[model samples]
Target: MSRFAPNRYRGKLIIVEGIDGSGKSTQLSLLSQWLRSQRLAVSFSEWNSSDMVKGTTRRGKKKQMFTPTTFSLIHATDFADRHERYILPMLKAGAVVCADRYAYTAFARDVARGVSRAWVRNLYSMAIKPNLAFYFRVPLDVALDRILGGRAALKYYEAGMDLDLSQNIVESFRIFQSRILEEYEAMSGEMGFHVIDATQSIETQQQQMRQIVMDRIGAALENDILRSPLEIDRAG
Candidate 1:
């Protein structure tokens, strides 16, 4: 489970992962924009944002009708759609692709929900390994507090309502997120996740993230590792 070395990739794929309220989305968005500001071509993608399956997924969630296996398959399909339609093209265009969450998200969440880890891994074998995968580590209480403060009600799946872990919403979310954090920690070594202490100020966390990403960008550019499917067309 060693990480896919950045040397092997055509374009940099940076993935940010964490439990709910861990600030992963915010940091990734900021980093992507910042890279663009520096004139690095960039394209952003997020989990479950594919148009092909959005309506179906939303309806399933609304009715709370998806079992663990069904939920995993739906998300896997969504990821596959986006990977083909959005991610691959961006990478082939030599754009830095920053994904809010990637395959590791399924490896953690689906396993926590009772899907077999090996099955999930095999399901995502089509995935392109990320060049940089950052795992935002936050304390359960802190994440719960932040989520509660921002929203009036927790989403059913996020609260682990599907698992029936607890009666109280807050307690359920806490239990669920804690399990997800444990799963994330377990995969850190195997996935080469750059773990960040999310308790740090947003500025500090972002600074550290940028420094690492910038270094990778420089190395990839120097090695000409980013020339891709459109190299001939672009040259013409």
Candidate 2:
């Protein structure tokens, strides 16, 4: 049996995952806007944003003190805190919960850092499977260009400098992100990720994503709309 089970909550959980600069964040933002425009209850979460562990993560990164195992465990703690505090409660309240990254991010990135895949998966075994998981697929070169074009320099950890992949920060990012990409590809089939070609124009990608989301949960959203106070007032 799969370690992660489908959630039984009334709300829908939608998540997007990809290596950094894959444009998954942009797509999720657009989707969240659309969901709100439809009057569906919507909530948002981002990985590593939990206050509980953010300070520790920052200090560790600043000091370059995190080994792969400690990094993995700290992130797991962050996810756990968010899962219990924000995700579960909002989901139970029937809010459409959108996440920028979920456990799969850890699965891919942690394993790419040389953590054991089985151990990492076991760490996130309590996570509820997302109703829709989108993997934004982009070529490494394209993703690199996009990231570097926007930023003056890569942060040390973001470049995967801790792994000693390359002396060049840009090259290190390329190699590190490549490993993460491979992990995502391997898990896509097993985890049923809807892969999006992220190299396309932003509008086109967003259109396809919106359509897929509508197809998956349009009826449920419509029901929520109908039950909303404004709709009830109109009917009365």
Candidate 3:
């Protein structure tokens, strides 16, 4: 059990996840706006956004300087910083917390990079679970096509270039993303991810996600009346 789990929490931690082009970031941004429109206190966090490790991680990937093990450890450090600086503070304050990607990114991406799944899980065991976790599932080809269409070029890390899996970056992204998807699917059952079909229209997906968020807020509050924060009563 996590040391932080002993204390009662009033805030809800919601996480959205998927491959690079799965539209989770976009949705999370919109969700934050919608939550605020309802006058809820919302705090948003993104993967690798920690100031403590971002510069080092960026420089490493830019120079192709990190091995898989190094990359995994750096990400774990980044997440640990996030947990301390943003997640823990906001949740304890009873704010509704939204994360673009959480520790599961490490679980899937790190394991996909050949790191041990058990090791990665243990690395994140100290963290508290999210009140709601969303996994957007899109086909590999669809995700890559969406990515390639808008971007001028894929970043080396994004393409899994460090892994040396393929001479072609496009093919490499396909294979790498497929592995991540497999890991996420395997984890969804155990981790309680509410799977969202990414093939759906943006409006439809957003609507569904908001509904789930509303339902979860209700469930969490019902579980403990003292846990209500940034309340969104249905009648309101």
Candidate 4:
């Protein structure tokens, strides 16, 4: 399993998803580094990464008026631009692309904010599905504690909001978390959905994540690796 056989997938589109403070970014970096060490050509991407999306997030944060659905829409646009301009092309070229966040974030967060699950799904209906999606699972309290301890100020939906809204969001997130976990679990039953424990120490989590990536990209882990497939063609 050094590298995928040329016929395996057009390229590998790996998406790491989770709630805030889920340590996804750290693990994503570690996994990407490991892939590079194996001589695989890997590129990294993130949501709200483009200038337009970043500006939207900033303006919304400043105004503190954007709803969950508004935020979700912005993120969806970001992904559309990202996929059309970056991801799809890379996959076509047979390159491994790892995304820091994906539509699942929108699906979860928006639903927590009261957006219908159908609405969220419909918004991302055209987005590309990931070859492997890693959900970092952690306790709600632990994640909130980490956020509170961090230095960053709250953004839009998080800032200057009443306790009612905040509390509603929190409770909603709990439900959203459970539902998304179930969804991921179901998908995993059918395909590749790897759930990583987000409660572990940073070093331990990174090592575990790295090992998972190495295993999935096994054999392809050697020198002069070719591009991995993005979509698994079962028909062939």
Q: Which of 1 and 3 is ahead in lDDT?
A: 1
Locate the minimum summed-lDDT window of 10 residues in model 2: 224-233
TM-score-based ranking = 2, 1, 3, 4
Candidate models: Cα lDDT each: 0.84, 0.91, 0.83, 0.69
Tens digits of lDDT, candidate 1, 16-74: 99999999988998887786665667788989999999999889999999899999999
Q: Taking the candidates one at a time, how many backbone clashes does each contain?
A: 0, 0, 0, 15
Number of residue pairs clashing in candidate 2, backbone atoms closer than 3 angstroms, sequence gap of 3 or more or interchain: 0
What's the distance in Å from true for residue 192, model 3?
Answer: 0.6
Q: Which stretches of candidate 2 lie over 4 Å from their true place?
A: 224-236
Q: Candidate 3: give the clashing pairs.
A: none
**Model 2 per-residue lDDT tens digits across residues 71-127:** 999999999999999998988888899999999999999999999999999999999
Every candidate's CA RMSD: 4.8, 2.8, 4.7, 8.8
Q: What shift in Å separates residue 114 of candidate 4 from its native position after superposition?
A: 0.9
Q: Between candidates 1 and 4, which one is better according to lDDT?
A: 1
Rank candidates, lDDT, best first.
Answer: 2, 1, 3, 4
**lDDT tens digits, residue span 1-236, model 3:** 22224235877888998888998998889888887776667888888888899889878888899988899889889889898888888888877789999888988999999999888878887787888889999988888888899889877888788889998988888889999989988888888889999999999999998898877676653443233256577897
TM-score to true structure, per model: 0.90, 0.94, 0.89, 0.75
> Which candidate achieves the best lDDT against the true structure?
2
Clashing pairs in 2: none
